[model samples]
Target chain A: MAKVVIEALVARFPGDVYDPYEGAGGDDCAFVQKSKIVEVCRFLKTDPAMAFNMAPYITAVDYLGAEPRFEVVYNLLSTAHNHRIRLRVKVPEADLELESVTTVWRGANWFERYCLDMYGISFRNHPDPRRLFMYDEFVGHPLRKDYPLRGRQPLVPEREVKDIFRGPGPVGRD
Target chain B: MAIEEKGLGERDTGAAPRSAGERPFEGQHRPETYDGPLDAPLGGKQMVVNLGPSHPAMHGVTRAVVALEGETIKEMKLDIGFLHRGFEKSCENVTWGQCFPYTDRLNYVSSIMNNVGFALAVEKLCKLDVPLRSKYLRVATAELHRICDHLTLVAAMGLELGAMTVFLYGVEARDLIYDRLTEICGARLTSNYVRVGGVSRDAPDEWVEKTLQTLDRVTELRDTIDALLTRNRIFMDRTRGTGVMSREDALDFGFTGPCLRASGEPYDVRKSAPYLVYDRIDFDIPVGAHGDNFDRYLMRMEEMRQCDRIVRQCFQQMEPGPIVVEDLRYVLPPKPLVYGTIEGVMAHFKLVMEGIKVPAGEVYSYTEAANGELGFYLVSDGGGRPYKLGLRAPGWPMVAALPHMTKGALLADLVPTYDSINMIGGEVEQ
Candidate 1:
């Protein structure tokens, strides 16, 4: 079943697909260029022959010394066909950016934000491209290989509390 | 804060020179310069209020800033991450087998399910097959945890909405289930009972009997809740048509479990992609006509019954045998063997020193968790520790779609709507 879907995908986009390996647990995994992710994903989601409706998640793995330092993975499942496929996009450290797939599946919004928050990978054209899990003031990506496990930072300053019983600004009357 | 005072004669002299078409004050003369309460706007406009980062109805530290025009909510924005503990980052540092305890914190209400999910993901990566008895036992434990989770959620939702009796009954039933869990495993709340290959311990002699008694109690409680809330005018008025999510919208938001089933899509991971002995089980998938808070509540009630049936069948079919795999590489040797033989001691030492080494690959394992599809995307570089671990919590997307659910609903409807979704703080923020 996976071979049929992979073959169909390869026939449509020849140069984009490469080194299709049967995943460790029997799913078919194909490596594709980062540039073609959005297009390929849209096809896989909407194509009549291979309609992969549910996108379980989008995550990235950082390979410290490899040429392409990161591999962004998307796990797509076809609810209609009851089959699964994995798409891995090699993302170099220097250019750690990929097109956003929120337009294809609205569920991808937070998953993409998580990838950016953990791996320092940016997604172009994301509707709300703010940090999801980390606070606005958090420093470096904590999930990177170089980040120290016990690294700590100073706490954010607390805001002053207002007096609830008092009416407006200053207490004294003019 | 200084209070602005009106002039001494302002109250009596309020009737200013009337314009051509202006009407006089109705009865009593009103003060010309009057300021309303501090929180309300002076002019008639939408009021902005923060619901909670620590309120009881929020389940945990989750804040929702709601904009209201009178009693109706005009806009809502969910602010999360107050409970973020960097679970994925922690997994990167821990050994493969050591991550099980951490999974317990994800969905504390159903900690055993999270443990099972992580164990299954690691087992898939290692290409290890668990024993048949263990398979049935896993299903039994997972289903038991599912019922407990649903009971807690229903109880909390009821308590938030002033149903004291329902809360007491639900918690009582859940505590009974916990007693059984404590017998099977050592702990009740965070039962790290699942390992890479199999369960940590076998069931006690009276475990099945106790489970059957608890199932009866839970069913009776479910009936009481159904009679109390299903057709009651107040409960129906408050929950029906509130936070209505259509099938398309539910799918677009990546809903699963009873919530998605209530939306009329039978895309259960157990049915679509059977992992354990689910393929052999016979049960009906209950769905709802209108995906509203009421539908979600009723769907969970029906699911608990289905889970009870699954547990009964598991005990009927399960046969006595080895609980863990026979492979010495994955499963730990018995204590007698370890103290009696030199090879057993060496094996124990190696197992403790070096955790199970997974192959260099990736697999995405998802289960029909209490809330929805709880997925674990694991990437292993042939090391004792995982290269990367991503948890696809169902609550994450549910929290993301909260604004959509509460857009134009009444402000008071927010609690029931949010509670119906069952957004766990640990899972969402992780």
Candidate 2:
């Protein structure tokens, strides 16, 4: 069932897309070149036959020792066609930036921000490139494999609340 | 004059109708302080107001910074993650089976659904078929949780929107279900009752009968709340045209579940890709036409009725069989067999020491959760610990689109809009 979608994509971007891997659950996944990802996404959305309209989830996985340290994943769904495709783009650690697909699908806005916050993979030209989950003062991308599970972070002093009923009292240190 | 004509309870929602994208929230910001005369006339600028990371009216720990021009909202920026405990990071470090307790907290309101979703994803990766009876149980329990989730949404929505009776009725019905669920899973909330291959236990003989009786009372309460809010003039006037998201925008913003269905998209995960025994069950997906708050409320009401029908049918169609899958690698052997047989002891030891061995691959399993499509994108590296567990919390996208939805609507309208989205911060912030 997913083979037909991959065939359509291959026919369209024969030069750009390669290494189509069929997942164990029969979901078709194809890796697109980082440079042409947004173009591929635009085509996928606008094309009638492959109208992958909704971008449900976009996340990143970091391989600590691998050549391309991070892989950004886009899980695209098409309600019109009742199908979904997984799009992957590998990014090297040195150059951890890729074109954002928020323009292709507005829903990708927060997910891209999340990827940036968690994996330190920047999305170029993102409308709002602020961290989605972590605070602005957060030191590192917490989701990276290198980040320790119980790593200590610098905490700011609690602000003095003068007119509050139940205040955040002083941190007791003898 | 218009306010005097209809008063607060009956003011038309479309009194100040603005076009789709006409600088509603775009390019609107509170200006920097001005150095004017001490008694100078007031500069009519949009006032910035912050609502809850801990405010009483807020459903969860989320902060919305809104720029208000008069009573209408000119812009809104949502600051989430106050409740994020790094669900994906924790799940990645833990064993596949150990992840259930963590998934249980993702949407703590309907934790069983999260367990079911994760289990389904792992089962898909392992290519294991769940037992028929367990499938029925999963569907039934999931629907029950769906009702709980909707009840929470409706109750909170009512409490904020000046309908205290609706909140009371909704919570009472939800409590009745929770009592039965406690009997089944030994917990009121966060039931980690689903395992890799199947569920934790079967429904007791009388459990089905008790649940059926509870459903009748729930139906009565639901109908009462429906009567109170469905046609109430104030509820209609407040919600009729505010928070209007069009069909195109809803799809474009990746809305799913009841909210998506309310926007006229009949794309239910259960109906689109029937997993479990949903194919055999007789039920309908109630789709809404208007993409407004009232329609969203109505969608939940109708979907609850559908959920009731589904639960009843699952019990009737269920056949007597082993509740858990026979796969020893995934399921723990019964205590009697574990103490008696050497094979059982070996299986139990191996399973306890080293979790179920799932083949290395990735699968994005989605289910029709109470809020919408709850998806878990899991990548396994042929090990006990998962490589990556990307949680697609259904509320994430909905909360992301809040600014867009409430761009030009009144600040008061934000309550119902937030309620209808049903943004459970445990899942959304995670």
Candidate 3:
């Protein structure tokens, strides 16, 4: 896996793979430029030896005190070898823009959208950039560290909700 | 106002109309926030149907506003957070020992798995090794939880399809297992028996014998149900070709557990990840060909049989020894020792008051819950409390894949598709 990641890096970026963290079971992860994740991932999936065929999950960690305050981790699995790889990509809390891997793995579309919604991360050229959990009226991201749990917006009036009922018969249960 | 009115489609025209009948409900149909102009780009007319943040058959307070072209869903926008009670944030505020009870509510169907996952995460961060006996007990309770969860799924699906008999039979069988669980732990649903380093207490010898007996009956019932449903003409017609998901599509959508396995992927976490006593247990990871609703249903039934096999294996191979490891720093001193011995009393007091201080480390712990690979990621900043805790819930992934599964399919197939996934809203939102 190290050999594949390293080769993918060298072949694609020539000298972009830097500061590699090689774990047990020959899993190779490197701190590549955030811009190159999409390109690298596309190649990694298509690359004959690597074949990082499945995207298990994608999650972001807030390293508030660290120099790089945010890190996105991707867990990838290969059905061919039944091996797993953990890829870490670091980004600053201030500038959390990273390329979306939706082009490479369609499974990442919702996850990337969720990360964007909750953590206020920016995904460049995402297919559908919409808030996931929060409503259209919600102003700020809910999952960010600085975002307060309490809301500033006033609750919707009961009168407003009552107006929306238009069915003839009893709606739901009587 | 209460008034006497004659029947035959209301003969109250002579009497004054009630105040409630005079009001007309009318309002502007505009969203609270508008980002841009509502102009279409050469598209067909779209009607919207909102499927609840609070509606029946949503499982919980989850809503999806789906745009439809006639009866077909053109696009869907999922609205969540009705059940987000900040359980993860609460995990930080509570003591390590106190958090076990809270984990019970995350996936209420499979509380034992949640306990095991949360405890395992903390244990890994603290670098605490559980005793061999503790491992066996964890496996037993976890598998039992799996059986119960799968039973609920099958029964719920049966109910949705108007198979009231199947639903009742499934629940009756599950109740027997729940009774066994109650014997082992005082609580049936919210069994916070899994402690950080070990279980809350050792299972009584008679309780184990009873559980084994209950499992024997449960296996028989599961086989009977499988036989009843697998070849039934109506069951096959209703489920066999309904909500089919291709293997490629299933993988692309991140579908796991029986949903993924039904598409012919053998990615069981017990076999692949090998956590707890799973490495020692002998069981098969069942897979299906068509990835249809029936295949998903049948796979879960087969899985219950495997669970029975695993529980029996635990009982036969489990050695009688100390269930809790002798790590006083992590595991609390025994109750008898705490009451009788002075040193043990102080140890227990300190553990209770100050809480166990896990070292500064981040670890991702994965356990095969009833749903799928339920993972708990804990980051501790060398403090007594966790800096951040994230639960990798399986329900949301299945929910996220709903659009893919339901698209181009009949609107009526929606219930069967949703029920087969058995997504508990708390599991997704939390």
Candidate 4:
């Protein structure tokens, strides 16, 4: 399945497949242009032989001191081909916006939202762009490299929930 | 135990209160306040529901703030980190070798895979090769671990549906595997067995023989479980069409392992991305056609049977030799050298204190874990500690797709659908 996608990518983008990031043991190994991401992912999903219909999940890596600083990695696997492809988009700390693949893969909705909330990456065309993991009041993305190692920030208070553990006895005296 | 069907109504996290038809897991208890949003639409008709970091159906302490209307969940925003213990940040502070025990907790059930993944990452960083004996030993223990994980999931899925007996049976069988693990390694749950280049120590003769004997017992127990649930009308009916995710849906969501295979795809990482001795071994990848909840259940059962075969094969192909590599830079010196020789003692002390300096490189190593494709993506900056570490947790993807799988289904079906995912806490907490 990845062979077909790589072939198609090479055919369509010419030199894009041999992008600098694809070099062996490179820091930005899986890097691909953010502009062509949605198109490539759509082709991977729709192509009958490489029918990778699910956008399973997206994870972000924070290389704070490294060249690119941030990497938004997508793990796409095809049920049809039983093959997997790791697509990475390297963005500097200054610019984090990437085209959202949710339009092509509906399952990417939550996965991309997570990348946005945790790493503070902006998925440009995300259908519902609200926070997924952190609350609305969260000041910074927790997964960022610059985020404090030992945070002095205020912690979110636990909600006072109904007592689902009540019995006919003292709660904590035992 | 009395099974209470609590219909907490639907709470969606994305939008204004919509009709109940759009919401999933309606009537389910959520965490936090589901009160009308402060920016409620003009008519002010939105009702809030909180699914929690403590709800039973959450699989773990994962909270979700859902907005609802009637019985429909309008939009659901998840609230996690209630179970986060700072594994990644802590790994940076600890010695390189000390991190093995912690990896066991990640996807708690499949400890061996987590251990193997971490060991592989460190091995790549250190450029050390494990002994042939250690490789076979790792495979043997890993296969056993996979069996235990599958059993636990099957039992948990049964218990979810009020089938207490099946849960007990599976738990009992798991106890034997736990005992076997305890015999081999000192601990049962956190078997910090894998070291940087190899294992902590070679498996004792008695332990290996005992594991094979226990496996024989496990086969009988597996057959009983098979007979009980395989064709049971109730089990079949409930799971047949429940949580029907297509092959396309499974792959698009980046599903792997049994979940993807259950959807009729034969993409096992053991075969596709063969590592360790998986390529040398011959085993079949069990697949299902419908990709329903039932297929997931049956696929897991068959996979466990195959794991038994793999374990037997590892034992038959076992070779005796030094388990740890001879490289003093990568692996600590032997016990005699560490205890008697000054250089060996100093090397051990240095490794324990400062940790080994790993070459600057990044690698994504994945193994066929019981749940699915368990991947460890580690980034090293030519330092003693890892610069960035991430896991492509299979459970995260499975749980993320829960809403899509349950959207139109009745609230009662949600529990079984969730159980089929077999998601443990470590991966989802992040």
Task: Give the DockQ (2 decimals) of all models.
Answer: 0.46, 0.46, 0.26, 0.24
- Alpha-carbon runs more than 4 Å astray in model 2: A157-174, B1-43
Worst-scoring 10-residue span by lDDT in model 2 chain A:
A160-169
User: How do the predictions measure up, each by TM-score?
Assistant: 0.89, 0.90, 0.84, 0.83
lDDT-based ranking: 2, 1, 3, 4
Instruction: Please report the candidate that would top TM-score against the real structure.
Output: 2
**CA lDDT of every candidate:** 0.82, 0.85, 0.75, 0.73
Return the top candidate by lDDT. 2
Between prediction 1 and prediction 2, the one with superior TM-score is 2
Docking class of 3: acceptable
Worst 10 residues of 2 chain B by lDDT: B21-30
- Indicate the DockQ of the complex predicted as candidate 1: 0.46
TM-score of chain A of each: 0.89, 0.88, 0.74, 0.75
Model 3 residue pairs with clashes: B52-B63, B53-B63
TM-score of 3: 0.84
- Evaluated against the true chain A, what TM-score does chain A of model 1 have? 0.89
Interface quality of candidate 2 as DockQ: 0.46
